[model samples]
Target chain A: MEIPYTISTRPDTGLWNAKIGIWLFLASEVMLFGGLFSAYIFLRIDAAPGTWPHGLLNVPVGTMNTAILIMSSVTVVLAWAALKMRRYRAYWWYMLVTILCGVIFLTVKLAYEWPQKFEHFGAYIKPEALWKYEKYLGNQRRAEKGLEPRIEITGHLHSENAKEYEVALDPVNAEPDSPAMDRPHFFPLPVTDKIATIEKEDVERATMFLPTHSAYFASYFTITGLHGLHVLGGVLVFTYMWLPVSKKLYQRNPEHLANRVEVSGLFWHFVDLIWIFVFPLFYLL
Target chain B: MSLKAFHIVFIIFSTLLALGTGAWCVWVDLVEGAPIYLAGAIASFAAAIVLIVYGVWFYRKMKRLRIIT
Candidate 1:
């Protein structure tokens, strides 16, 4: 059950086995995320003018998550530093904070963000829908602002029937005549703002912003969902390393334990780096 | 790569992200006139500068460390 090179570097490679293995794993991860990122770029490029969604995510929330991940990265590095200095208690506290950061990030995403998206509804009406649903939209105001006619209304479903659906719209956004909507972006509006009804036949598409909603939602859910899983993985790994059993291992082989922490730290840093790219791509730009 | 080198790369990457996102938020703010984007821009640039200082401190401290059993 003994493994060589866990602590000491290999003569030929000048590195431990775990370091090389983790690099290989991380290389594959890069390609995986790279492919999806490329797809997103193409999708954005291919979208029709003004048809592509923007500003649909909560920028402040997204930025906060970025900060949390960055802080976690710092704590994880500090944890490794403590281990190197033989400060086991300090390492434990730093690792605990790192784990808590990961937990908080996931909690905000699942408990607050995604649920906020789920209960809300959005629909892109059929082209002819304007004829009948004119009063439900603020397109007249949109036109004065030199924007495209309003084809989408995002809010909560007021009611639905065999023939029609009643809904509230213009929710959590600028007032009907407010200048904010004049901007060249779409911000997230996930709430029951104002109410209106629509004939079911008038809608061409509807969604709760799930992955199946549109290209934007699909990319949003898939990429963020995968990233969430990674955060969860980091939490689990750090938790294991912080447990009492790991302390026993550290006491018996301090160098080996330090090397193990280093390896984990490298992976955790990789996770943080990915989020750096993710934040701007998904939230800001 | 050594773990130290990897950590350096992470810090460097984080710096770049902060700078790039800051520039982007500025652009978005110009177009949308939203105060939140303005706030984002300021925060990002601050984070970038802080990371630069932190990276240097980390480098100096880590360079001499050697794990002893």
Candidate 2:
């Protein structure tokens, strides 16, 4: 079947074949994210509904990132528009703005959020400090639910058998009355009762002996860590492309530079779009 | 919007919807511990379908317009 518009051939012009190839590649990228999304769906289903809100994230921070990316998207589109008009100076300016936005986004991510999470990674902080943070989060969640916030208390002990036997954290298994299917058996706790009263100092020993109590912390790190890596990768790629444009290397070969920016823009957009999904999943939801 | 535009918007909107609903499922699972994963899966599947359709349509449109060689 013949396409309606015949391909244009101009010397050093951005070719249709290249554009098509890029689109095809982008489709595959969609599929790549599609797979991550599918895994997320399955895992989400496995989780008990309406119950997994980990309380450490700040929604406003994520929203700010979203706005930054959206604005960058606009700048790049203007850059492309300027290129179409062969307005090289405008192209450089808009593209530079886009690149600057990307840098700012990464800086905020690393400077603020990443360090905070790293501090909670149980690496440098004392056990008491870690416990305090966790309790603080739990209290924050309670407050959000309209309950008067009380001091976060860590009294729940990890079941000894919890290590040998894995409990299904999925809601299906969480049903108090569900037939114990694949239920991880836990060694009887030294402390009696489902809710154990724990002091800040004892929380470390208690949590180490039993880890599932801190599953939220694990999930928090995993999800945000994945996002941070993506931003880092984007920064490297954008920086490489950014230099050539900054020097007006593109003025000599507008189409080539345009093609490079187009490809990079596609990638940058994908990264931002993925974050759109990540923001709510990790922070708001 | 033209058919092509419609498809583009649909794909974008559906993707967003699926993500939103998926987050809701996560929230619900973490809180009420309800059986909402099935619903979330369905929504995401639908979104993926929309995206696939949009991809094919967009590719074809670009080809017709000679935007892609």
**How much of the real interface does each model capture, measured as fnat?**
0.76, 0.00
Write model 1 residue lDDT over A58-150, tens digit each, in one string: 777887888898889889888888887889999999999999999999999999988877877777789877756655556777777677666
Which ten contiguous residues of candidate 2 chain A have the minimum total lDDT? A181-190
lDDT digits (tens) for residues B1-69 of candidate 1: 666777778889889988998898888888877888788789889999999999998887776565321
Task: Sort candidate 1 into its docking category.
Answer: medium
Provide the TM-score for each candidate, comma-separated.
0.91, 0.53
Q: Which stretches of candidate 2 lie over 4 Å from their true place?
A: A1-17, A48-51, A121-223, A244-249, B1-69
RMSD of 1: 2.6
